[model samples]
Target: MVEMTGIVDVAARAGVSVATVSRALRGLPGVSDATREQIRQIAAELGYVASPSAAALPTGRTGAVAVVSPVATTGWYFNAVCEGAQEVLAANGFDVLRYDLSEVETNRRRVFDTQLLRKRVDALLLTSLPLTPEEVEALHAMNRPVMVVGPIVSGLPSVRIDDVEVGRMATEHLVGLGHREIAFAGGDPDDQLGFPVSPDRRIGYAEVLREVGVEPDPALTVPAKFTVEAGVAAFAELWARDVRPTALFAASDEVAMGAMHEARRHGVRIPEDLSVVGVDDHDMSWLFGLTTVAQDVRAEGRIAAGTLLEALRSGIAGETTVTTVPTELIVRSSTRPAGQSAS
Candidate 1:
């Protein structure tokens, strides 16, 4: 093995600034791939490896980040965001401490305390969970760089898509197809985490209906969890009501798929008896031919992680910049013009 050397010695041999060497070695952004590769080769030859504790000594940081989200392993949106953020954080020589939350009130409330997080991480990333006023106070008291990946919160940076507009787009697609009879399938508004995704989308759906002189009908709205089974149950709600809406705007692809499954069981032909659209072009959406509003969810995760890194580096945790990602309507076999029968 070559003579064991310190980071400074590696920086000296790399012909790059210490920051560049640090970033390159840690796989952080801002360094060219070529530069990173060269730095790695030089460090390897010099027997250099990053020491987590030694690096954090200068900044008094723990070199770790806390990511608090509703179970990161489930929910395509939450899972994808976690993966993206983890990729960035882990690559940057930072340990990711994930705290999975459940709908249980106590479990959700425990996150806001931050009693344990203060001693652990240099920054925090909260994904898709809305904070109560008191909880917001706790974050301020923590006084660390924080990033949110959902609806806007006062005095915090966030990365999210316009969920309200997402609803509008899906509703408009069905409404524009000349189907005045419409239904909405969304998540329960009383979710313990208070995530605004579904409610905002429902607002958009309602706004579009009113704009077209179609009064929003309470009887047509079905609220459930964001899952395939929930969607099936939502379809059952409609079936029981005997409501024959020509079009349905499901809050998510999973829900749309579930509803479609139930619809098929009842001998309803897709785009013939009903036209359906959903949000989030789920990985399996194409297989089911469900049209949907697609958003770059993984990109949202990456951006949120990058924003946190920037915030940590800049030392300005109170930055309230809300980054909005765009969404688009992807038409597929699930929808056709109203009154157009399949030949």
Candidate 2:
């Protein structure tokens, strides 16, 4: 068994003073690079793990970041966020503590309201979870820095793409392809969360449809949870209608995959009989040859983590910086002229 020791052990082994060892280990930049590397090497050779809590007693900094997310098991978006957050946090000598949000209302309330997270983590990275006004107030009241990744909420530092623009871009892409009869597949506007992003995306779809002289048809718009199954089911209902849309603009890649699967099952050719476009550029999009509007989910996560770390270092919380990253359209085989089916 390896003996557990404190900074004194590392300092003694490194043959440096305790204060010099402290600065080198904490990643403070004043020490010479050579000295820092030597101290780090000695510490690693001894398998020494610094206790952020112990350090915090003196410095008031934990050197640990917490991630509060809705679900970690599902969603490529969340996975990307985790990946980016992990990369950045590791690079900066901070540890990451992830808490999978319990979906049960009571559990969620307890998780958010209780001191379960307080005084344990130095900063927080909130990924794609919509915070209510009260919740926002609770986090702000903590007096610790927070960086939200996805959806700009009031009184929080955040990084997000223009979701409305994503929708508009998808619609405009189809419009440019000479598609007028475009359909939108997404979730209910009045979601349990009551956030307006879904509806805003739907609005963008309708706006582009109107700009190009096509009246919005309630029949062509389908609502489903953001999933592949929902996509398939929504498209099924839309296709069953007497007059089907020539093209579809799904709010997410999972939805697009579902729609494509059902279309293929029904022997409907893609881009020939029905063109499709989606958002998020999910990994499987390439395998399915899906044309999609691409957002930097991983980059957003990395930036969010960076922002939180910066806020933590600056000792400022609730600074409320709104960062909007850009998006792009990746042309693929899923879209073509409206009447031209997949070849």
Judging by lDDT against the true structure, name the best candidate: 1
lDDT of 2 by residue, 3-62 (tens): 678889999888889899889987888999999999989988888877767878977677
Query: TM-scores, in order shown?
Result: 0.83, 0.88
* 1-343: candidate 1 lDDT, tens digit per residue: 7555878888889888889999998778999999899989999998887776787677668889988887543478778777889999888877888888876477676777777677678888888776777787888788888888877877778988899999999999998999888999997756765668888999999999999999999989999668888889999999899998888999999899999999989888898999999988988899999999998778888898888888888877656889999999999999989987664
Model 1 clashes, total count: 0
**Best of the candidates, TM-score:** 2
Worst 10 residues of 2 by lDDT: 107-116
Q: On a 0 to 100 scale, what is the lDDT of residue 201 in model 2?
A: 80
